[model samples]
Structures are given as structure tokens and as C-alpha cells.
Target: LLNSNLTSELLYENFLKTLLYSIISTVPSCVFLFINGTMLFTLRSKPVFRETCRFILLFNLLLGDTLQLAQSQIHFLLSVCRVKMVYSLCIILSMLANLTNLISPLTLVLMPLEQYVAVCYPLRHASIITVRNTAAAVIAVWAVSSLNNLTRVLLFFKFPFEKMELYDLCSNIALILGVMTAEYDRAYTCVLFVSAGLAVIFSYVGVIVAAKSASTDKALARKARHTLLLHLVQLGLSLSSTIYYPLMMSLSKVLTRMVFLWIQNAFYVTFIIFPRCMTSLIYGLRDQTIRPVLLYHLSCRLKVIIRG
Candidate 1:
């Protein structure tokens, strides 16, 4: 009886650990996505800036991030409830999550790339990254991501997991998706992870080089540097979390697992909760447009309170 009780406790503990890690892994990304999306939209609304390729890329990136947020929420609810739904629902959400994850990073890579091109090749930038071309590129990104995820989904249904009592059926479906198309899925994920990282790294490097060499206005250079730094931080956080999935998937050692778990949790706190907590601070402290907008909104509410 004592052994049985101990065994039960162990199982429950393991279950909780997995659940906690899963939540920590996904929830923070969702929160950050929403916060960044809001910030991007606010930035877009400013009348001072022209609608350029960089702006278009940023908008598409936000849309992709928003999709990812929805996917993460769906995944979180599915994990917490442990409810088994129709296989179709599992496949749908899994595909959606994967598609969003893929597209978000791809589009994020493009934003900085577009900015680099615009800054470096100002003469040809207009023809090279027109609105029509930008829209087509965005569409191509979604198409590729969607098709890849859909193929994974189709392959997942071919796997036989007849007797497994899955704690979370959604996770089971995701696992099936991974295993059935393990080679392709792993390859695609790695490629995207590496490509996005390289793109961001090179884009920023180009930005830095351009900033250094260009005989531009000091104020513009200062603002560009600040913006680049903020973007680099965001990109670093995102890439860290994105790569973590593959790392956790590949590593098997207990100590390594523990370290990864800690890092994963830290990533969540930094990216997810920190962003929401710091959004007002970021606006008030950093962005010119956001500061006045925030102040106006606050003042309007205060006036209403005083009148009441």
C-alpha cells in the first residue's frame, strides 16, 4: 500500500512537471505576441512615417504573431483540460500552431531584411520591395507554412497509436505529427530556426554598418540605433524560445533537462510577463508617438473620474 501510494505520488509529480513546463513554454510566447502586436499597430497609426516595405513587413509579422498567440492559447487550454476531442480538431489546431510558428519567424526575418534593403539600396528599394511584391511575399510565406503543416497533419493520421492513453490528446496529435514526419518536420524547423537567426543577425549587422558609414543626420542615426537595439532584444528573446523547442526535443540527459527547464521558465518570464508589465513603460519611456497617445488616453480617463 505504501509503495502504491508512493508510485501514485511520483506519477502525479511527473505529470505536474510536464504540465508546468508546457505552460511555461507556450503561454509567454502568446502574451509577448499580443503585446508586440499592439505596439506595432500603435506605431503604424502614427502619421509621421510613410507606408513602406518595412512597415508592411512589420504588419505581416504582427499578424503572424497574432495567429501564433491564438494557437498557443488553444494549445494551453487543450493541455489543461486534457479533454479528448475529435481527431479533426486535434489536427486542425496542431496544423494552425505549426503554421503560425513557422510564418511568424519567417515574416520577422523579412522585416529587418526589408529595412536593410531600403537603407542600403535606397535607389532600387522602391522597385524591389513595392507593396504588391511585399503582399505576394507575405502570401507565399503563409502558403509554404500552411502546406508544410498540412503535410505533417496528413502524415500523422497514418501513425498507429491505438492503445496509448494520452494525457493530452492534442499533445498526442502533435507528437504523431512530429514522429510521422520527423525527418521533414525536424529539417524544416531547423532550417527556419537557422535561417531566421542568420537573417536577423545579418540584417542588424548591415544596419550597424550602414549607420556607421552613412553621413546621415545625427538624430536619425540615434533613433535608428535605439530602434535596432529594441528589435535585437525582441529578436533574441524570440529566437531563444524558438530554438528551445528543438533543444528540449533533442537532449536526453537529466541535468541538461533540468537546466533547459530553468532556462525555459526564465525565457517565459522575460518575454511574456515582462512585456505586458513593461508595455506602458516602453511607450512612455521610449516611443514618442506612444508617449503622447498614452498621456492623452490617461488624461481623458482622469477627466471622466474627476467629473464623476
Candidate 2:
């Protein structure tokens, strides 16, 4: 009886470790998703911006982030409860999370590219980034992301493990891949690190060049500068997370785990928390149109409470 109890205790401990990581990762993501959703809805209602492309890009970003958050939540619950369901749901959610991550970065990359064209090639920008073109680009982004994620998910579900029976098969896949192809994982990490770094760097450089060249509208230049700064900070956080992910995944020693946990916490705070907080701050304080609308909605709610 004591032996059986000990075995159960050991298994539970192992399960808890994975569950904790999933929960910690999911909570902040959910918070950010909520904030992004609120901002997207607010932006959609307003006609302050004439550039539909920018709106669409932002909307897609929000959607991707929300999907990621939802995926994380489901994964966390599964990890904690050790629920074994049909393989189909597991595959679908795993694919969805991977798709969201892929699309988020792709959309992020496109945003700066669009901004660059708008600022640098103003004469032909309107014609180049029309509604039809934007729609096509978005469709292409989704198609590529879905296919890429599907490949990874398939690889994950096919791996075999004997010692640790994974209640959630999707996680089993990730563990197998992580262990079997560490180099492949590292290479993927490097790509994300480099891509995010390049996007942020080039975007800011373009913004700086535009601000420098624009001698006439001082107000517009100032606003552009502020926007550039905000984007730079956000991208910097993203780059940091991308860099940290590989290191955390590869490290093995006890000391390394401690260090990795601290780094991961920092990454979460910066990338997940800071972006949403900054978005709220920027729109609330800087954007004249959004600020008034937000206030009006709040005031109406408050009036209803007072009257009741």
C-alpha cells in the first residue's frame, strides 16, 4: 500500500510541474488578449483613421493573440486535470496555437512593411496596398501559417514515448520533438529571434528616416516619432522573448532552471503585460478620438449605476 501511494505521489509531482508552467504562461496571455480585443472593438467603430490596411492588420493581430490565449488556457486545464479526450481536439488546438504564433509574427512583420511603404512610397502606396491587395495578403498569411502549424502538429502526434505516458497527446508530441531534435528546435528559435530583431530594427530605422526628412509638419513628425518609439519598445520586448525561449527550453541544470524561470518571468512581464498596458495607455491618452469614445462609454455605465 505504501509503495502504491509513493508511486502515485511521484506521478502527481511530475504532472504538477508541467501544469504550473502552463498556468503561468496562460494567465498573462489571457489578460493581454482581453485588452487587445477591447482596443480592436473600439478602433473598429471609429472612422478616425482612413487607412483600412492598418486597421485590418491590427485587427488580425488581436485575433491571433486571442486565439493564442485561448489555446494556452485549454492546454493549462488539460495539463492540470490529466484529461484524455479524442485525438482530434488535441490536434486541432495544438495546430491552432501554432497557427496563432506563426500568424502573429507574420502580421507583425507586415505592419512595419506597410508603414514603410506608406511613408517612403507615399505616391504609389495607396494603389499598392488597396483593400483587395490587403485581403489577398491576409489570406496568404493565414494559409501559410495553417500549413506550417499543421506540419509541426503532425510531427508531434507521430512521436513515440514509453516511460512517461502523456495524458494529453499534444504535449507528448512537443516533449518528443524537444528531446529528439534539439537542434531543429534551436534553429526554429534562431529564425524567430532574427526575424523579430530585423523587423523592429528596420521599422524604427524607416521611421527615423521619415521623421528626419519631413521638414514641414512638425506636429505630424512628433506624432510619428511617438508611434515609432512605442513600436520599438514593443518589438524589443518581443525580440527578447524570442531569444529567451530557446535558452529556457535547452537549459537542464538546477541552477539553469532557476535562472531560466527568472528570465521567463521577465519575458512574460515585458512581452505579454507591457504591450497590452502600453496599448491601453497610448490609445487612452494620445488618440483623441478613442479617448472620448472610451470615456463616453464609461460615463454612460456609471450614470446607469448611479440612477439604479
Candidate 3:
């Protein structure tokens, strides 16, 4: 919400500006979507990925991530078009976004905990992280996230509104309609991130302890340590996104409209898309098993594009 809507210039008033932005947002998103799709396929293409517990977890994480990217692009495009959706439509879109977004961190927890067992409890890793158990874990992740979203939906109705179809810009921030809902949301997010953070930290510490053992393969311990650090970095990026809008809203108070617009786009890439892409990149490029197959599929895509 700018104080001066049109004192001098519009951020994207003309056709060229609109087209410019649409291209800017869409191109990278499309490339990443393609990459994510390939990664998902790669995870399933191999028998090893199917049988391995870690790959199963990675596949589950990628599923949530791919859907979130699709939904997030929709949200970003709507905002860029400066479209004001009706309240009902906004609620549905935003809720869907939240539902998809919640899946990552929840899945993040499971992935690390699985890795921890693979590293720390190596003897029991196979028996404990069986295919059946992995399926159950995936189900529980969705169930918890769904329950959280359901509660969010219920709290949404508690807000008494002037109109059911009032027009407003749709965003994640718009979900805070009532004081009670806001408080609940704030509390729940705090608890969720903190718990997730602690769990990842616990896994990291356990891996370090395992690394100290003479029986431990130093190479495996080093890889696990690096992976946990990547997870922490991912968590940091996810946490930054939760505050992205509010931080931009604050900047809008001081900055010129044009500058603010530029910064917002940069920030979106930094805080949101980068973290999402990091998962695929780290796994696809770094993991020995994934790298060869992922490269083959990606090269196939490149060849098709070249031939076209």
C-alpha cells in the first residue's frame, strides 16, 4: 500500500513495462519448473531411488516443492498484474498456497531425521526406515500439515467482514484478518519453525558425534555434515521469506516507487526461488547416483529445445 499511488509515475503502467515484468518473472520460473520436473522424474526413474529411504524422502520433498513453485508463480503473477481478486477467490488461492508451502519444512524435518538414522543408527537404518515405514512417515507429514491448514481455515471465518467479495490484493500477509487469527498464526509459525530448527540441529549434532567414532567412515560423516549445513541454510531462507512482505512493506514507506519495485523483484528471487532451487541443485549435482541420471535427462531436454 503506497501513500502516493500516482503522484508521478506508475511502476508498470505501460505495455512494455508489463510485458517486461511478465517475462522476467515467467522465464526463470519456467526453467526451474522444468528442472524440478526432471528431478522428480529422475527420483522415480531409478530402482535405487525407489528402494533407498533417503531418495524416497527426497522425492516426497520434491513433490511438495514442485507444487509450491507452481502455486507461487501464480501468486507472483497476480500481484505483478496488479489484479485485485475478490476476497473469496483470494482466500482460496492464499489457502492453497499456504497448504503447499507448509509441506516443505515439515518434509524437511523428516528428511534430516532419516539422514540422522542413516548416519547415527547405521545398524538399524534398514529395518527402521523400510518402504512401509517411509510411506507412513510421508502420510503423517501430510496429515499434520493438513490439520494445521484446517485450523487456519476455521480461524479465517471468525473474522467479521464488511463484504464477502471485497476486492484486495492477494498475498500471504492478507491471511491475518482478525486479531485472534493473527495471534494464532504467529504462535503456530513460531512453534513450527523453532521445533523444526531444533530437530535439524539435533540431527546435526548427532551426526557430529557419530563422526567422532573410529568405526565411522570419515567420508560419510563429512557428507552428512555438509548436508545438514545445507538444510540449515534452507531453513534460514524459508524463515526469511516469512518476513519478506512485511520487510518490503516497511521499505515502501521510504523508497521511491520505482526503486521499491526493483528491490521487491530481487528480494523475491533471493528469499523464495533460490531456496527452492537449492534443494534440486544440491541433490541433483552433488549426489553421485543422481548426478549422472539427472544430467542425462536434463541433456535430453536441452537437445529437444535445440532441435525445436
Candidate 4:
């Protein structure tokens, strides 16, 4: 069954790229998990960070990203080793990926709405959006994302993979997600994407208008505007890969194995890791409460290092 005509050098190059990429991604994955844990601890005791809705959203977003990163590395290892994923494991990974990915954008969409409520409805903000309410919202996001992806999982089970299901790359997994659920997933994804996109856009637009209305506090207005812009930038990055799943399906059909591997690597760096890293970095730098706490901890660590 093996391709006897193919050269061993080609196989070696592919393995080398996969190994290097796995290492590169693993470093940041570990860093983000640490940052997220620190942020979670900072939220627990700091009244200021605890009360802020945006920081809570960021915390959950980072948590989701951490899980996604972990799953990605697992898949990468499986690919590099050329291990065939069991049917049950593939389904589990597919569900986990769906859960994490959906939670992020949905959390992001809610963030702008949270800001809009705080900015536009200051008098009612406390009554409507308390700490309890924000926590409930995050729970609800997880619930809804699970429900949405559950449909796909059931569909996936209904029509299982026909072959041995061996894969040497992440793209292969993605292709499975796309081709297997092509009929239902496209419509579902498009609708879900469009609705969330519209909500984010509208919320940000309202936030901008409300910020501009506060002409007396120019500095506050400027900061609000900048924060809204950053959220928009992050949202754009998140959705830039909105159509990529389906695109991967098409690419796999046409491209050669090596060509697809390079393109897949490019997409992973650009779409997968970029947004996850930048969004957390933006939150860590932009949030007043988080930044000081992070810096203080960093300085303390540095001092201990010097003393040692």
C-alpha cells in the first residue's frame, strides 16, 4: 500500500517542519496558560479587576484559548508521529475544538455589548450588569456553544469516516470537519458568524457614538474610543479565519501534500496563534488593573532572580 516511488527526502522534510512547528507553538501555549492563571488569580482578590466586566470576559477568553492551544499541540503530536486517531478521540477533539473556538467569539461579541451597556446606560448598568450577571453570561456562552456544536457532532456520528482515518497534519483534520459536515455546517456557520459579526459591529458603533457624546471628558472619551478600536481589531482578527475551514476543504482537494503543509503552517500562525496571543497581550497591556498587577509580579520575580 506504500508509495514505493516517492523519495525518502520528501518525508524527512515534512517531519522536520512538523517537529519545528510543534516546538514553536508549544512555547507560546505554555506562556499563555501561565499568563491566564496569573490573571485568574489577580481577578480573585482584586476588587477592581473582579468588578470589571471586560476583564472577566478576557479571563474566560484566555482560558478558552489555553484549551484550544493544548488540543492543537496534541493534534500536532499525533500528526508528527503519524498515529491514526481513534474514531472516538477524533469526535472528542472535534467537540472540544468547537467548544473552545465558539466560546471565544461569542465572549468577544458580548464584550462590546457589555461596554455599550456601561457607556450608554450608566444609571442602569449596575442594576443590569452586575458581577453575578457577567458570570452567568459566561456560563450561558459555554452552554450555547456546546448546544450548537452538539448538532454537528451528532451529524458527524451519523456519517462516520469511511477509511482508516490516518492523518499526518492538522489540515487533514480540518478537511474532515469540512467535508464530513459540508451540508449542514456551512449554513450553520454562516448564520452564526453573520449574526455574531453584526452584533459586534453594532455594539461598537453604539459605543463610539456614546463616547463621542461625552465631549466634556475628552481624555475619557479618547480612552473609550481607543479601547473600542482595539476590541474591533481583535474581532477582525478572530473572524478573518471565519471562512478558512471551508477554504481548507477546497485547498486539500487541489494542492499537493507539501504545498498544503506550508500553506497550512502559514494559516496556523496567522489565524490560530496570532489572535489568541494578541488579544491577551492587548488586554494585559490595556486594562489598568491587570497591567499594574502583572508588572508588579514580574518585577518581584526579577528581583528574586537577581538575588539568587
Best by lDDT: 3
Winner on TM-score between 3 and 4 is: 3
TM-score ranking of the models: 3, 4, 2, 1
Question: How would you encode candidate 2's per-residue C-alpha lDDT over 1-308 as one tens digit per residue?
Answer: 99999999988976776566666666776655655556666667666533478767766765665665465556545644556765555656666666766666666667767766676667788999887888788898898787666667666655653434434434323343545354555566567556755775686677667767754244654565566566666555544534433443454233454455445555555554554345455545576766787566556655776899
Off by over 4 Å in 4: 1-17, 160-180, 212-218, 299-308
What does candidate 4's lDDT look like per residue over 59-177, in tens digits?
78777766766666566556545566456566677677777777777777777777677767777878888889899999998998889788877776666468536444443344455
- Lowest-sum lDDT 10-residue window in model 2: 165-174
Clashing pairs in 4: none
Quote each prediction's TM-score.
0.66, 0.68, 0.91, 0.82
- lDDT for model 4, on a 0 to 1 scale? 0.69
Clash number by candidate, in order? 0, 0, 0, 0
lDDT of each: 0.61, 0.60, 0.80, 0.69
Off by over 4 Å in 1: 1-50, 161-169, 172-174, 178-180, 212-226, 243-308
Clashing pairs in 2: none
Would you give me the overall lDDT of model 1?
0.61
lDDT of 2 at 185: 50
Model 1 TM-score (2 dp): 0.66
Model 2 scores a TM of 0.68
Q: What is the lDDT of candidate 3?
A: 0.80
